[model samples]
Target: MKRILIINPFGIGDVLFTTPVIRALKENLPDSFICYWTNERVRYLLEHNPQIDKIFGLSRGDIKKICSKSRLRGFGALCGLLRNLRKEGFDIAIDFSLDHRYGLISRLIGIKKRIGFDYKNRGRFLTDKIRIDGYADRHVVEYNLDLLGLLNLTPPASRNLELIVSDEEKEKARELLFKAGIYERDLKIGIAPGAGASWGRDAVLKHWPPKNFAYLADKLIEEFNSKIVILGDAIEKSIAEEINGAMAHKAIDLTGATDLRELAAIISCLDILVANDGGPLHMAVALGIKTVSIFGPVDPVVYGPYPVSPKHIVLKKDLSCRPCYKKFKTPVCLRDKECIKSITISDVFDAVRRLL
Candidate 1:
């Protein structure tokens, strides 16, 4: 079978954004089998994609895994993977990863046609190197899709988020919600408090404060008759718990409790999700949930919420430093996150009122 390999090697949000390119490739080349390479943690995001023939997860999960013997094993695995692809005589190798590793590997494997961006440290290896033209000042999904222009492919001008929720996943979410005493009739709201990096804390401040979120939960319970749910990783559980503790009504804290798949499933059922501009926000959008994401420091124009369906919102502050982080890193700020802090609890509550 003719084959194509797409290397993303990035975050959950980036992987979600790349799904459109995968879809476009499949639509254009229906006969060529396509595969993806990404981190193990993000594998669930692409599960059940009709266009993907397979998904390979890399080994680097945490800091220790990178330092252990697993590193050597992973390198060997990567080589073996490349060799196996060579044996298949793959027709094309596309490095969607914004890094040199995949580009160099694509070159090493000697695919018939290697494709990548004309960017720093990796342009020489690709047979097709497309330059990124004035595309950074927009949502990442659009930026990723722009790469398809390299192949003369014009995808439908639509924002789409892809994910597969099986019966098993739905059942699991149902049981979890049932166990949490959340009934179908209760208005369900989801909140994500963690961001990708602490540098993006400006975005966090733009978010409704923990106490403010707590107050909103209280209002939702009293006025809207809503039940709240908080989502995050282990690191953000403490924050979720703190918010839950302060609330007048009880909320199910799923932070650190659900894996990526289960998290997606559970979020799919929510009436709405509130989050900072980050992975969970993207995930909620993919699931077709009404999500309100707060943005500060970083440019929302480049990473704003674009619900694949019709129900999502992004709240951004107007400031000169709105997008100071050019490369997704923390900026050396003169003011300590004033851009985000300027956004108040009232702003988020008003949005929730509108969305809910």
Candidate 2:
């Protein structure tokens, strides 16, 4: 194939997980030009990806507007995207979304070969369709890589993500830490205070109580004598600040203070990370930093830490509705969020101490 397109319309963690697929494709077909289409907010995660020739970002705001406005706008944007694809003359298009929408988009683009999962309403439009085994306990990375097998490509030996950090980004992160009064030699623990953007009260409830986090922070300080760094985007600044505000031991609130690359750089330097099951957890795993990730509604087995080893610890309670992965209109349980609340600050503190 002279040109290829890989579609991943999701958040930072999804983008990171899919990088191994991109790397496999590049390794198999070195001469082909590969491009990725992803959400605009997280396109930064793919910067300096050697496998990708170009990255296309779809604006969420524009998508929202298109859905709200005349249907013509959405179709117009699709047509524009199709025209762009035609101009590039891609020989193969892969709908990694594994959903009907991306499958339909691949068909509309009219690439010579389209490949994706054989989901409901998905086989009609593609040249290659692979039926998932419907096997239990399969990870998402494994599912995504199965697409390559349909193309007669062998699966790579391992699944891992590589995030590129520029020299400039490293310097900037160093400056940020320096300003925060952290020295290079000091032992540090990183904390991700907020989960990813979510839909309703479920989103707010996913977080551990601020008091719980503060309690852990104080214990880490008193026990380990470690400096704490709270990581988040601007949207989560308030949450990070809330945890910081409640803590008697001061934490370096780096929320909204750095971009993705800088955040990765800062996280990589840390001795350990304590976080919710979110993007920062993924970053910590990729950077080979020890992390203790707290999970409530989500199952750690499916989207858990990569390069699984002793360094990574996932804590969760076993509940009937524990794996309520998607955000629901109503609460998953009668107790609202017993899973998260049951995860005591002492549990987290003990995990961090052991990891350290």
Backbone clash numbers for all candidates listed: 1, 0
| Residue pair clashes in candidate 1 | 138-302
Cα distance off (Å), candidate 2, residue 138: 2.1
lDDT of 2 by residue, 1-356 (tens): 56988887777777788877887887788788998887677788888778889887774444766868877887788677668866787778777665676667667666778887665555667788876533236566777788888777776656777788777877777777888898788889988978757443556656778788888888888887888899988988888888888989899998898878788889877899988878889888877789999988776777778656898988899887777664223344677688888999878888887886
Residue-pair clashes, model 2: 0
Q: Compose the digit string of candidate 1's lDDT tens values, residues 267-327.
A: 8889999888778888888777888777776676777766333466667678877667666
Please report the TM-score between candidate 1 and the true structure.
0.90
Report how far residue 354 has shifted in candidate 1, in Å: 1.0
lDDT of 2 at 131: 69
